[model samples]
Target: MALWTLFGLRQGSATTRWPAPGGDDGQADVLGMPRYHPERCGDGCSACADACPTGAIVADAAGGLEVDYSRCIACQLCVEACPDGAMTASGDWAFGVRRREDLRWAESGDPPASPAPTAGYRRSLHIRHVDAGSCNGCESELQALNNPIYNLHRLGIFFTPSPRFADLLLVTGPVTNAMIEPLKAAYEAMPEPRWVMATGTCAVSGALTGGGYAAQQGLGDILPVDVWLPGCPPNPAAIIEALLMFLDRMPQRVRGGQYGE
Candidate 1:
């Protein structure tokens, strides 16, 4: 027998049974987007907002800070800068949502309910990914989906080369001016009832490079997005969670910039 075959037999299956109850999703001790505790905010403290490189947190009209999760790169600068416990690091990585507004932090009122999953994509999903101008961080995580540890195909989700056959358009990077036409072309090629997913913070809000001379902001102006997943580069498991949330196989965990429900 081949050496690889022998190793495989010895280790059994390396793939995780995640997205199912009790299965490991492989992210342990990983820090995700920062958690904002408005109650713990110190009087007139602007440390967190000032430290945020991507302008994810900014001064609101009330002199308080407003957090836009879409622009957050999860660098933990705000958490480190906060004298109070208002901004703290967290492990809540699943930040996928259908609406862009839900990614902003809100102090009161009920969280928006998750939109019903599209009936047609419940069983399987085919994705077409575009790299507009990424640093390849998101692409690295995406490649891991096919590794033995992830085995993404087991879940019936796949990455297809052709946009015409894809159900979702997964985009990475802060789209550059050069890619605008091509990106639109890809979206146009997809059949009707297709969905779009902004796969990283760069794609969701242009990250630290928004409004540059060469790069446009995120996909907000370019195309309609059905799922917005923000991370500097979201891990493989988080990406999986986002897909499931889109298909309604799992409940959305983040709303109003808070993790959970």
Candidate 2:
């Protein structure tokens, strides 16, 4: 019976190399924001600026473009508005911070710590994930880490089911009322010197459904968020970038200006 069960395991599947199509290869994009080509830009039409849902893109008198990524929604609207294809979205996605002030716009804080030089300093992190009330988008991306393409284990990062053994807590969803106690208990159960990572728009700023009755306060209101992964359930590569950013394995960016400015 044991041999039959062992034989039941699926095998003989083709294996792909690291960074299988559409996988992040650990290269941080120094230019974390999008870049615009002025030559390809036409006159000051303001279509891209108007199309911007968050008003991240603006036009100048010289028919040039300005993008405040701190406000940009990364909706790709500007890329679609450019008739000449002047706007292009770059893959550079490393963005993480240790303090809210560091992430806050118009607030200059102390510089982040320099990345550890030796790979040995990179600790093996055991992550515990909790779904407060997410739409399951964040969970989907989290699962991608197990895929051979991303292979998070290569970096010594792992996901564990038990919170007691976890070194980091990866949370999804906007802290719903029903989940508050569970979330708090989970954090309290973990060992000291632990980290909490809030992934997705719901967990970060609450995004659209923040004011809902079921939604509790933001993740920050409940716990000290060590990392914030902003997106409507960010892409797999984006998740990898955020995780790497938190570990100080990539360059960090200090965005300027106000939150809604």
Write down the TM-score of every candidate. 0.96, 0.65
For residues 1-261, could you state the per-residue lDDT of candidate 1 as single tens digits?
999899989999988878777889888899999888888887788999999999999987787998999999999989999999898888888988888888998875247586654855555789999999999999999999999988999999999999999989999988999999999999999998899999999999999887899997888899988899999899999999999889888888877777873
Please name the candidate that would achieve the greatest TM-score relative to the true structure: 1
lDDT of 2 by residue, 107-184 (tens): 333444544222344667789999988989878878877775667787678889899999888888888889999999
Full-model lDDT for every candidate: 0.89, 0.66
Candidate 1, residue 205: Cα displacement in angstroms equals 0.7
Clashing pairs in 1: none
lDDT of model 2 at position 199: 80
RMSD of each: 1.3, 6.8
Distance from true location, Cα of 52 in model 2, Å: 6.0
Model 2 has an lDDT value of 0.66
Q: What C-alpha lDDT, on a 0 to 100 scale, does residue 28 get in candidate 1?
A: 85
